[model samples]
Target: MAIKYKVLPRKNPRDIAAPEKFYAAAIADGDVDLDRLAELISYQCTVTATDCYAVLHSLEHNIIGELEQGRIVKLGRLGNFQVGISSEGKDTATEVTTTNIVKSRILFRPGKRLRSMLNGLTFKKAG
Candidate 1:
């Protein structure tokens, strides 16, 4: 099955001329929630669906716990996830404090296997 994309017109942010460019943005085919994911895993493994759900739920809890401690969580063959922050800049290094932090976000970097799959993906225009 091929991945699908939609062509979108985006304004060039760097150009004052405001030239419009078309970009191919992948369209989500569908969503697989936790229950569905567990069922799929169970079909391919000896573990039961209930066990798969339990393990996946445990993983979610641990990932958040480690990230709260400012640690990067690596999911081998899938990706690495880490916390990213946006903060107000201070003129003096000593003036910087936790209060300066504006927001926190999760950043994911795809591992080699995941990235390699992208190379084989075929795209079709979305309806």
Candidate 2:
């Protein structure tokens, strides 16, 4: 049996124009209403405004909660995020032991499928 695969046109940062431009053009074209356009974009992008905000909130809470307890949180296929201490003033090279002096950062690790897809495809410039 032949393997079936869906081929999506690769889009580069340069290939994409400003969202405002596209939105304006779409509105001018009258192909859809504002609400319909919003819904279409949301569905195609796998996220809506509400969903994005919720996800951001969840991530912030999870990371902060873990760090407060001195634990590294590992998001599957998205890497390990951690909070670590740093000293201020002249002793910038050393880590501070105090809980009050720490920095938080989010780390990401791409999944195998995502990595493979990235490696396998080459983006072509749209004329």
Provide TM-scores for the models.
0.88, 0.35
TM-score: model 1 vs. ground truth? 0.88
lDDT of 1 by residue, 10-125 (tens): 98888958879899999999899888999999999999999999999999999999999999999998999999999999999999999999999999999998899989988889
Scored by TM-score, the top model is 1
Runs in model 2 with CA error above 4 Å?
A: 1-47, 86-127
Whole-model lDDT per candidate: 0.94, 0.55
In candidate 2 the C-alpha lDDT for residue 37 amounts to 51
* Highest-scoring model, lDDT: 1
Worst 10 residues of 2 by lDDT: 20-29
